[model samples]
Target: MQRLPSDPFTSPLWHFVAVLGINGETGQLRPAHHFTGILAGLIYTARAVVAEAALPSQDRAAMADLPERLAAIRKAWLCKSSYAPMGYVLNLLLYGKKIAFETGSRLAVVWNRDGTLLYFQGRPLAMETIRQLIASMTADAEDLLWDGLLFRPRKAEAEAEAGSSSGRRKGLGLLEREGRFLIPLATIRDDLTQTQRGQSFLHTNGLLGKEKEML
Candidate 1:
């Protein structure tokens, strides 16, 4: 697969596993959405500080010296998270990776036990989302996301269709509103294989296997 950019600002928001939350009363750590919210929140705070600092002297003076305050805030914030540096935090967010803040001080990329990246920061990072980001980054990789010139189905939708076909539709598995195209992970692999083959056909007008296409 073509490489995706690590920038989070422009990336699509994907589904992610929530791993940390802020304490309601004690202000301690609680299990919450993956670190995406915190990461975005921090970035927003930083940008806001910078914007406020750019205002007239009276306004800026009330907030303290711009450079000193930013530096202090950066220092304190950086010290709190075990996450990557601010530069990387921005990059990861741009690329749509799920970020999880471990505590007030540490942040890290969330990964599935099998190592397939899920949603960054409690957002869903589905294959379609990644593929879209990749398409935005590179022209040559555009075809990778097209199946016979049509976009691939979202994961939840495909699953609902499959479930309906199986004649066993009684639960919310097939009723998930957001992920209408969500399919079982197993079907994802199969659909991907077919999608690739179809793309190859559209691009070359001939059937081809992976090795043959590589040649």
Candidate 2:
């Protein structure tokens, strides 16, 4: 079996994956469709970082420790709030025995048995590329955040924006689109919904969306 990178903490990106149960060398659970949530969260966290960074210096210090803030937010959501339900879903997927890809197909999101991300089929994505993908996904997440925080956009406007982004993506090949293998949209949507629900629960429970300790 192919070995993954030696250092787990080498990238902040891996921290997001770890939150989803992918630990060092061995994953806490089997890989499943729910793994998409890690990707989504990575995207959101990366975008949130950028958003905070762009604020005026005075405002920036107020959010200077965003990663720690997000870490606490995620911990409460994953370990405390929805632990049982999330564990149940994880167990179900673990025992469900789904194939990762079609036989004879070289294209796939391959992982080591220990759950380390290997490559998309034959190509190894650069770390920067992975970060770029997260950044792109953050844009989508930002739109939803804006809608929730402020006034909602018209359905037509939302659809148009989504469509235009999709059109822009069409020029790129699947691998090039975000430097990661593409998951089915239905799967991504379901995963995203779960993540959003978790975030909502966190917000309601006073864990996120306000000034808080970086625990």
Candidate 3:
């Protein structure tokens, strides 16, 4: 009999997983239609941080602190449950075999026995793959960020500001509103199912069309 290819997603161990948002919120993974934006936004944001240049030293220093900041944010917001970033999903898709083991995959997000920290074990190959993936995605995202497809700054503004000394541009950093980095849900569109199309959290809160207004 001809052998069939193994389906990693169909494995029993793959079941019972929860999707985590950028904010570390746990929920069912949205359909691809809605989820793509979240993934794009995150990858783009990470890219922008990695590629940003000519900003004030303070801004540069803040970008340098992104990993620690993300860790702290994850700990503070997701202390109650297991969670993983969207990058984990990308890593899993690109290098599943390298990251998966007999027990489970780190891409799926597992918490420690005491719930102290999220942990994943992988071979060196998996680790390298993840590192390279992050680099590549960040590069791609940087391009998008420069094009203003990910953040709010227009391409013209980015080009003009590239030569400026002021680092006060909006959308130059991660999502911030009211002195917090926590993005309001209104900024995200739920363009997935018919029922969710027009009922985005932002739309429901009368914050829809704000992005266009900003432009």
Candidate 4:
């Protein structure tokens, strides 16, 4: 299929299936596994690095066999393809069941509008995990400080030193709950209320997010 640069969706985007605030986060939203989120970024970055033949040899080998379905979904998403509805794609991409044994209230996480306050397995991540995630995302993570919400680079005495690449993303994040505060196309849950077969898909596949279109 030809790649579509932008969405052609003229109708309402997607049905608000999942009930929000049942836990804490509001509105019907997609919940992709954190690992899958990382993979999405990795593949996006790698595709470019590889095109330039700049990807490291070791990482290149690791990506030899890209997940076909996952890659396909990512393409659809990156291109904002109207033909490939992201709401359906998110359900398809979440690698939930493979990690189903870990599926519990503790495994289910949520986030707020601005992506500041976060809860994992129903609680804030431990300090060490947050530190680790910060470290993974940046080289100057040591210069960063957290103040209950999000991390920010420290203000160094020297102007040049203070503006260092502390905010740079060295790589995709490990654990982050980042998504938008979406307004669903409709206030409907019939798609979810109608069945447990879908729930079975969640168990067997223990899964798994969108946007852009107008005129």
Candidate 5:
């Protein structure tokens, strides 16, 4: 695979996937678990740092070992991949933070200064994608924070009944919903539905408070 841009502002990019490890004996997102969201955060942070540093080269062989290291940590801690955005939403559950959208509702977590666990509707992430991200993380976590790639390889999925009245479908609690969101060149189209939806959310949420109306 070609090198992924470390800058978050890059227009053409891939969405990285992060998987949360669950307990085999018990079911819950563990804060102290070896594979906490911090690993995902740190990985991206490292990528950003590498991008900014005056580095010598971009090599794939070197990147391949990172995931192995991360997996070792997960195993050492006895954590299993829960298939939810637990790594992403775990921060919100721990601190009074937000993802600037319906993420909390979608992830099914509530907020408080004290510790509390909340249930969410989501699926486990694709193992391949998770592997890709772990291998991609370089040794530059500290500097990556400034470039806004601190949480790059994390995504959330939901479950719904076979059919739903509304377009919104309920997400499964612990499995990654299968299907490809990426558009292949052979199946490309001029449709702008996704762009419009993202824009609508930004507009509705006051992110573009003074921006002109976009159709």
Candidate 6:
């Protein structure tokens, strides 16, 4: 299982991507993308986001309002969500888990229960959409989504009893425990930022936004 490579800045016009989290001082943002190599929009921090990355040369006109637009979106996400920028590792982990659980494993558009914030609207994340995108990758693209891999029919059957017989788990006649089982994987800030493809995989994919914990 692996994330497909994605380059979202193809269009001359700026492509809008929602933010998942951010650091206030630095221009870094946690971009929202599915398995399109953006870390499921779950918990990967991106490098600085700018229209300049999309354009071959710096076209001032194309990026004139990028800063203002980014600021506005970041502000909105911070106000309504539980993610805090740069420092709080706990908030980052909770938010990531919440998104993955609610969205059922694919990195798609997610919102708070109140409907004030929306995520990954740029691509409209869904199973079919994800399947189509993966097919576009290569002839033998494998699904790298954590949840899909975790709950696959055969894999689940094989690993249902993988862990200790008494460990807590998710779907197997009240006895299923596999892979991570009860051991929490996300304990520090680095856990959220770490990626199988290396830190570079966390880049914003040429879109934008992040912020502080409000809940």
Candidate 2 is scored at a TM of 0.21
lDDT (10s digit) by residue, model 3, range 1-215: 01113443443322322332222334344433334444455546544543443234467565766666656644432222323332343444334333332324225354545554453421113444566678657545655653455444444454454333354345344323311122345566655654734455444655456555445
- State which candidate, 1 or 4, has the greater lDDT: 1
Worst 10 residues of 5 by lDDT: 174-183
lDDT of 5: 0.35
Residue pairs in collision within model 2 = none
What's the CA error at residue 145 for candidate 3, in Å? 4.7
Model 6 scores worst on lDDT over the 10 consecutive residues at 206-215
User: TM-score for every candidate vs. truth?
Assistant: 0.22, 0.21, 0.20, 0.18, 0.16, 0.16
Candidate 2 residue spans exceeding 4 A from truth: 1-8, 12-16, 22-28, 55-215
Candidate 1 lDDT over residue span 1-215, tens digit each: 01124433332231121222353433665433444556678667655654455545567657656776667655543332323244445654544443233335434455556555574544446665676676446422322443224343335453444343243343234433422222343433223355543343244422335333223
Taken over the whole model, the C-alpha lDDT of each candidate is: 0.43, 0.44, 0.41, 0.40, 0.35, 0.37
| Clash counts for the predictions, in order | 44, 0, 1, 6, 13, 5
- The clash tally of candidate 1 reads 44
Error of 2 at 161 (Å): 48
For model 2, what is the C-alpha lDDT against the true structure? 0.44
Worst 10 residues of 3 by lDDT: 13-22
For lDDT, candidate 1 versus 6, the one ahead is 1
Ranking by TM-score: 1, 2, 3, 4, 5, 6
Task: Report the C-alpha lDDT of model 6 over 71-154, residue by residue, as the tens digit.
Answer: 654443332242323113234345655665566545456654655444464333455556555644621222232235534232
- lDDT per residue as tens, model 5, 76-143: 32122322233223343344223323233333343333333332323234455555466345213312
Query: lDDT ranking from best to worst?
Result: 2, 1, 3, 4, 6, 5
After superposition, which runs of candidate 3 have C-alpha atoms over 4 Å from their true positions?
Answer: 1-123, 126-132, 135-139, 145-209
In model 6, which regions exceed 4 Å deviation?
1-41, 45-61, 78-215
Best by TM-score: 1
TM-score between model 5 and native? 0.16
